[model samples]
Target: MNITFLDSSTLHHKNDLDLSPLKQFGDLTLYETSSIEEIATRIADAEIVITNKAVLNKELIEGAKNLKLILSAATGVNQIDLEAAKAHDITVCNVAGYSTPSVAQHAFTFLLNFATSIPKLDSEKQQWPQSPIFTRLDYPAFDLQGKTLGIIGLGAIGKEVAKIAQAFGMNVQALNSSASSAPSGEIPRVNLEALLKTSDVISLHCPLTEETKHLINRESLSMMKSTAFLINTGRGPLINEPDLAEALDKGIIAGAGLDVLSVEPPAEDNPLIHSQHPNLFITPHTAWATIEARHRLLDGLVENIKNYLAGCPSNQVV
Candidate 1:
C-alpha cells in the first residue's frame, strides 16, 4: 500500500498542511517535477498516486501498473485522464468544498473593491499633494447596500457568498445551470438573461463543464449593464477572456475582477495583462490558497486517502 504524492509542492510549501495522517498510512514519496515525461519512472512502484499539478495521462497510467488510486489535492481533475484510469480500474478521488469560505471571501473582496474603487483611491493618495487633483474630491465611491448581487452558481460557495452579500444589505439572486430540487430561501433563482440585465455585481462560482465553458461570452456581456461589475472566482475557461477584454475596452461593463484566467500563469501576450483599462483587476489564481482553506483541504485529502485504504472510497469519481 505504498503512496506517492507527485507535485506535493503545492501543499508541502504551505505552512498549514498536516502530514501526520498521511504518514500513518504507508510509505509516502513526494516529488516536484516540471516534466510529465518523468512520471512513469517516478511512479513505477507506487500503489496510490496523489497529485496536485502532475498530469496522470494514459501513458503514465498504463505504465504505473501497481497504481490503484489517484487522489487529487484539488477539486478539478481535468489534468487526469479519467477514461484511461477507469479502463485500468483505478479509483480517482478529489477534495471538494474545502475552500468554500476562502473562495467566497475572495469573490467579496473583488466585489467590494469594484464597488468602492478602493485601488483607485489608494493610488490617488500617493500622488495627492503633488497633483492639483488632491484639492478636489473627484473620485467617488459607491456603497454596496441596496445593490443587486447575481451569482452564477448555487453550490456551497455560492450560498456562502449570498449569505455575506445579504449581510452587506445586498439583494442576492442566483442562476443554477440546472434547476435544483431544494428551495433557496431569500436568494431567488433567476434566469441568466434576467440576472445579467439586473445585477449591479455578478460573481461566478460554478465548475467548468461542457455546458458551462465560456458561459460568459460576447452575447451575454452585451446584455449586462454598462455600470455592472463582473467577478470570476471560478474556473478560468468559464469566461471567454477575449470577450471580456473587448467588453472592458468598449465599456460594456464597468470593470472585471478575475481570480482565474484562461491559462494558468497567463502568457505575456495575454490581453488582460496589458489592458489599458484601469478597472480590470487580475489576481494570480489563488482564491483557494488561504491558510485556513489549505488546512481544510489537507484534512479532507487525508480523509479521502484513509477512506480509500479502508475499501470504501470517499469523494470517488468515475
Candidate 2:
C-alpha cells in the first residue's frame, strides 16, 4: 500500500523524530510541507495519507481516487473535510489526549510566569548589581494559593491543569459552558459573568466554535477584575486579539499569556504581536509540541493505521 505524510515537518525537522516505524506498513512518501496546489497530485495514488496542519478539503478528497484513509497526526481535524471523507468512504482518524500533559504543563508555565513575575525579574536582573539592599523588590510576585483559577474548558488538559492548581492551593472553577460531562469533582461550575468577576487567573481550554469565537472581547474584558490574568493555550481566536491588546494597554486586565493565535505564524501586523506590553506573553503554538507529546501523537497514528489494516479501524471520526 502507498502511504504519504503531506506535512511531516509539523512533527519534526532535521530528522529529530522517527517516522521509520511507518515504513513497515507500506511505501512511505514524506513531504516537509505541501501547498494547496500540490496536495491533490501528491495523494493521487496513495492509499493512506497523514497530515498535521495541511488542509484536505472536498475537492482534494474527491480527486484522490486511491485515498482510503486519512490520519490527522494531531488532535484537531478542523483542516480535514469530514463530510467529504465520509461521502467518499475514507476513514478519518485523529489522535487525541496525547498532548494533555504537555499542554497542561505549558499553561502553568505561563501562569507561573505571571504569578512569580519571572519575566519581569529576569529583565531587571542587571539592576541587582547596583541594589542598595540584599534583594530587589522591583516586581513583587503573588502567591497562587487562595487565588481562584477559572478554567474555560474541563477536558483532559483542563482537568490536569486543575490538579496542578489545586496542588498549588488554588481554588478551581470551570465555566458553565465547559464540557457537559464535567463530573463530580473539586472544581465547581460558574457562569461566564461570575467566572470573569471572580477569577484571579482565567485559563482557556475551550474549542473554537461560533459560540466560543471571540468569547473574550471588550464586554467580557470589562467584566473581569482589573488585576485578573488571562491564559489561553487552547485556540487563539477564542479571544479577540485587538480587544486583548487594548485591555492590556488600558490595564483593564493585568496580563495575557497565549500559546495560539487566530492565525498561526501570525501576520506581522497582528495587534497582539505589536502590543509589546511587558505583561503580554505569546508562545508560537508550542504548548502541544513537546518532544514526548509528538512521539505519542506519532505512535497514535501508527496504531490507528495498524487497526485500520486489521479491519478494526480505531479512533475513526467518520
Candidate 3:
C-alpha cells in the first residue's frame, strides 16, 4: 500500500515518537504540513491517507483516485468529509478516548488557577518575602469543598472530571446531552436551565453541533452566579467568543478558563485576544497533547489500520 500522511507535523517531534509501526505498513510519504492546493496533488495516487487536522474535503477526497482508507490521527472527524468518504466507499477511522485523562486534568489545571489565583501570587513573589504580616489575603480565593460543579456533557472525560470534583468535596451535577435517561447515581442529571442557574462552577465537555454552538451566550451567562467560574476543555464553538469577552468585561460571570477557542491562532481583531481580563485564561488548544496521550493516539491509529486490513473496522462514526 502507498500511504500518504497529509499533515504529519501534528504527530511529529524531534526524534521523539517511534515511526517504525507506521512505516512497516507501506511505502509511506509523510509531509510535515500541506497546503490545500498541494493536498490534491500529493495524495493523487495514494491508497491510504492519514490526516491529523488536514481538511480532506470533497474535492481532495474525489481527487485521490486510489484512496481506500483514511485514518484520522485524533478523535474529532469534523475536518474530514464523511459524506464524501461514504459516497466513495472509502473507510474512515478515528482514535477516541485517547486523551481522556490528559483533558480531564487540564480542565482542573485551569479551574484551580482561577480558584486559587496562582498566577497573580506567582507574579507577586516579592510580597511573600516581605514580613508585613504572616499572611497576605490579596485575592478572592475559595475552597472547592461544598461548591457545586455542573458538567455540560457527561461522557468519559466528563465522568472523570466529576470524580475529581467529588474528591475535592464538590457537589457534582451533569446535563445529559441526549436526555435519554439519568446517568449513574453519583452525579444526578439536571436540565440546562437548572445547571446554569444553580452551579457555582460550570465546565463544558460537549461536542460542537448546531444546537451546542454558542451554548454559553448572554442569556445563559445571565443565569450564572455572579461569582461562579466557567471552564471549557471541549470544542471551542460551544461558547460565543464575543459574548464571553463581553461577559468577562462586565463581570457577567466571575471568569473563564478555556483550553479551546472558536478560532485557533485567532486574528488580531479577535475580541478575546487583546483583552486584559484577569479572569480569562486561554491555553492554545493543548489540553489533549500530553506525551502519554499522544503515544496512545499513535498506538490506537496503528491498531485501527490493522483492524481495517483484517476486513473489520472499529470506531466507525455512525
Quick one: ranking by TM-score, best first? 2, 3, 1
Q: Write the per-residue lDDT of candidate 2 for residues 123-232, one digit (tens) a residue.
A: 87888999999998878889999999999988899999999999999999999854344468657888899899999999999999999999999999999999999999
Task: State the C-alpha lDDT per candidate.
Answer: 0.87, 0.93, 0.88
Model 3 clash pairs are: none
Name the TM-score of candidate 2: 0.97
What TM-score does candidate 3 reach? 0.95
Q: What is the lDDT for 93 in model 2?
A: 96
Best of the candidates, lDDT: 2
Model 2 stretches with alpha carbons more than 4 Å out: 177-185
- What is the full ranking by lDDT, best candidate first? 2, 3, 1
lDDT of 1 by residue, 1-318 (tens): 788888877875643466667878889877755368788888999998888888999989999989999999899898899999999999999999899999999999998887777788788776677776535365577889999999998799999999999999999888854534336455677788988999999999888889999999999999999999999999899999999999999999999999999888898989888998988998998889987888888888889988888889999995
**Model 2: per-residue Cα lDDT at residue 49:** 97
Clashing residue pairs found in predicted model 1: none
Give the range of the ten consecutive residues with the poorest summed lDDT in model 2. 177-186
Indicate the residue-level lDDT of 92 in model 3.
Answer: 93
